[model samples]
Target chain A: MNDSQQNIKKNVLEKIRHGDVVMRPKIYFTLQVIVVAVVAVCAFIASVLVVSFAFFSLHESGELLLLGFGVRGLLTFIALFPWVTLLIAVGLVVLLEWLIRYFKFSYRQPILKVFFVAVCVVCVGGLLITFTPLHTNLSDTADRGDLPFIGQLYEDVHMPHEDKGEFRGVVVSVATSTITITHNDHDADADDGTRVVTVPTNFNTSILHIGDRVYVAGDMTNGTVTAYGLSKF
Target chain B: MSDSHPPYPTDEELVTRVQHGDQEIFGELMDRYTEKLSRYGRQFLARPEHIEDLVQDVFIKAYQNIQSVDTSRKFSSWIYRIAHNAFVNALRAQQTAPISYFDFDTFTAHPVYEDGHAERKEAEEMRVLVEKGIKKLDQKYREVVMLYYFENMDYQQIADILHVPIGTVGIRLSRAKALLKKELPVDTTHI
Candidate 1:
């Protein structure tokens, strides 16, 4: 309210009136708005995709630690989880919600409420998106080496644990720290592969009920495979 | 606000005129809000120099995106929302003076006022202390206090401007006052 400040403001207005500054063309603002909208939507979709990817990854990394690599490989596999994807997903969701805060209506509601609602919607959308054939289609595309980064990400997440030992069969026996699996890769043919493999696992081994389709990875010699990794196929 | 536009026009009508290419009315808006926005910017923004720039930027942006304005909503809230975003981004860009990095988490949790209802009193001394307290508070608290008292906006209006729930507006205001009451050593009524 000082005389000097008021004079400065009046001078600024006079300058504005006398064409010292020009308003941006209408199209520029329109384009800016359009770009913001597009970025917000893209951020939302990315969050959903990354969140779903994390979901599937978590589902695969069972709590049962198979002692095939003497817990080292188990530790590695656990660490190599789609954590980055999950983290990025969370970060994306937060970003999208933040962007939404700029909108007229979004600000009327509490941000925590907006954030929780946005997160739930994104998670549900991600789950529904997972049900699409896109996952399989993506895998197929990744298999042919068509997509680059996505292919690598898909390979890292979905490709069976081939780095160690890869075998799928049904559990025949369950011990305190070990589960015996009968290997049967080729069906309706002669028994060429290992007949049985004893896989040492963590204490939550009660999940290894006999007749369950299971996959195990470890050292296999003369049909005796000392397992390191185990998962429900 | 008139700028020779006859009797006062609603902000929505003025914005409509701008949308229809009557861009001069945008200046009317600039005239109306510049001082208010400047005061608001000073409350939370660390750099006082950027406040005028921020106000000018907000007007330019508002002028540009006049088409996107929803006529049903209050035009003042819409523009205030822009100012809020501008200040927030300005603060974020000021990495050298990183003030209250976690202020956004103000709405992430409980409404402390819900458990303990906050009383509304207006003491001249309290008001002065509140002004000093605003500068000392965190970004989130300072904003709600400024929006509530300085800008003379209600909780819903504050929520609309800040994009938070109305309840969050109350919680923030209450918590902000409590912090002020504690920090400024005002009459102690807040639990």
Candidate 2:
């Protein structure tokens, strides 16, 4: 060995002998693996729950019906979409993918491949979760005002987006020029849920029943909605 | 490399000993990797100063992290991974260029078709010409060429060391080779 190489060996050996540098214990690595695994599982579950909740929100609010109302309805749906929740889910998926990349089989593939698989897993898992009574039970708990801080998320699910010209409720009565519906504005069962909506002459009021749920799109004047588009839900 | 009839304990065997508290056996690892890391540092840093210390730091870090090594895998790959990080850190400290957090090339999949013997021969033929033009290539591309040609690491080993997809190793080497062809066209006729 050359002078510098020999000196490096000597110095490193001396440091080791003097206990200046010590190998980390096996438990340290074991704990790291456990921590990583727990965090990854938590991230995955959080991602799935958030995605399912988003779907539940769109379905319960009748905002999803806006997609059929035309371009303006589509725009309003886009504007009212729960993007913040989805963004959080996306961030979690990315974090999960990063953690998964530590594995040999996963790291051998490209990041995009692994990420695409992760997104699919989350979406499918989320869809499956929605099929369960999870969100339904949670929503029911929220309606009873028995839920905690997360109850507020479900409160808006049944509320109308009147500013965006969207209203959803059960039909209470039908008239030649107007229809009266009972909507859950603040309370689902309050008497104030009743509202008057004026429809165009060409609108087929004959298709409406007294107890049918409906979605109406129009401008709100005072407390009444002037209907431009209507669909039965 | 031929484990069928070996004259000495393999790097993995040495690692097992070190993990069992034989720290002196780590010197064997340092001996095996020192010249290799020195050559790597010289080519990677493209600078003479502090190369010895940088290599020494790699050994020190490896020694400290030895317990984390999986004895089932190639110890050479593990140590080379450390060397790669140390050299990259040194390169970064020089403020040579901005290293991006995300690289599009590694994010996507590419086809990897490796003919080990043919590629090794080709790399050997192109080594002299490539060394002359490697500095002109981008940092990402330069490192791949150095590992594949000079260090004699295969695509999988290089991928393990760099923590990129194996296909990414192929992509970078292909791109690096193309850049070399453009830079040293006269000397690369045989390659």
Candidate 3:
């Protein structure tokens, strides 16, 4: 080889030999393995919890025992847990291997394959745990009357009339696209003292009817009330 | 001179040592493969800046995942596989960005010889020209030429490293040689 060519080869070799490419330490690898194992355990626990919750909910409602089958359902689920976990674990490992091979990750960065496999195992374990027949408690529904703005909106819009010392109620009804609500209140005053208001319906205001609770803003004239805006509560 | 140790250890021995966490053995593997790997990277990627990075990545991966690799399989092939994967990934990443150029003048200016002589100047000029010529070739042709000429890889080994058919490697090498011949100075008596 020519002197320059030889020099180039030598230079290239020296550079290759001395070049620093930082890599994750062995401790990091060990930690990664530990974390993966922990994640798998946690995932398995989660799966078991899910199964148990489903089972407990069913059992407490007496649904499992009602059809003359007591403890058999629970016993069968318990018996199958191990097989299910094992299947899940095996599936996880297979999926991990397939992914690693398919992506050629091991060829690129080998440790990445190990990390991904561990993650897959954990995910599978979690799935196995969640598939168990365990119960999850449902929260109680809130009372609708306790909601804000409903009672005030109800009182302002509804009017009533009195006849011979007996009060007759004027009910106001409000309808939207999905719901309709009605409110009724009694007033001692009769026809001459009472006023009815008709508000124009725009984008914001709608017509009020019997058994409807509405909030109105405007003036009450001689036996005629003019409303500026009407809102249904 | 030939009495004691072989010039190169057997592939199996090297693999065993590497598996046992012999960092020097891993470095030996790097020394053994770097040229071929660099040429492969340069040819496939068409980028000089990424060549060393790709080579280093290949070696590191080989070291870390040596267990999964079958011991009976050719170590060179396994190393090449790692290099090839790294190069392909780097190439894909490059596609999304603009190409960058290195200062070749600065690279070639470093004197190869300490003696101040007219012959050294001529050789330096030729070296510069040759480097430029190699850089000018199409990425694929340049890689095959570099591997064949600079790294001294046979057609089959080049084919294995490149994951190409042996015939394809032969054809490419012939084409690359023809192209280099045209690019180089046509002196009847000189190399």
The alpha-carbon RMSD over the true interface for every model, in angstroms, is 4.3, 1.0, 14.8
Off by over 4 Å in 2: A185-192, A200-202, B1-6, B46-48
- Alpha-carbon local distance difference test for all models: 0.68, 0.85, 0.48
True contacts kept of 2: 0.80
Positional deviation of residue A32's Cα in model 2 after best superposition, in angstroms? 0.7
DockQ for each model: 0.29, 0.78, 0.03
Q: Report the poorest 10 consecutive residues by lDDT, candidate 2 chain B.
A: B182-191
Per-residue lDDT tens digits for candidate 1, residues A1-233, read 44534544555556547766455566776787788789999999888887776665544433233434456656655655656777788789889978886665675555677778989998998888777776757766765677687776655444334345555567878777666766543223344243365655553677778898776666768757776666675
Interface RMSD of 2: 1.0
Residue range A109-172, candidate 3, lDDT tens digits: 3333454555565555444543543212120110223335333322222232111111122333
Worst 10 residues of 2 chain A by lDDT: A184-193
Off by over 4 Å in 1: A1-20, A25-30, A50-80, A105-119, A140-196, A199-214, A217-223, A227-232, B1-8, B18-31, B38-71, B79-96, B107-128, B131-139, B163-165, B183-191
lDDT of 1 at A193: 41
Per residue, candidate 1 scores C-alpha lDDT tens digits across B83-123 of 89988999888757665544454456445343222333464
Query: For each candidate, how many residue pairs have backbone atoms clashing (under 3 Å)?
Result: 7, 0, 25
lDDT of 3 by residue, B57-126 (tens): 5666666567655577567766776776787678767787643432122122122222325433554444
**DockQ score for candidate 1:** 0.29
Ranking by DockQ: 2, 1, 3
Across residues A1-233, which tens digit of lDDT does each residue of candidate 2 receive? 68898778888999999999888898988898899889999999999999999888887777888898678889888998999989999999999988877778788888989989999999999989889999989888888888899988888787777778878888999998889998854545553467799984498899899998888888888888887778787
Query: Per-residue lDDT for B38-111 in model 2, tens only?
Result: 88888788574898898898889998888889988888788888988988888878876766768888889999
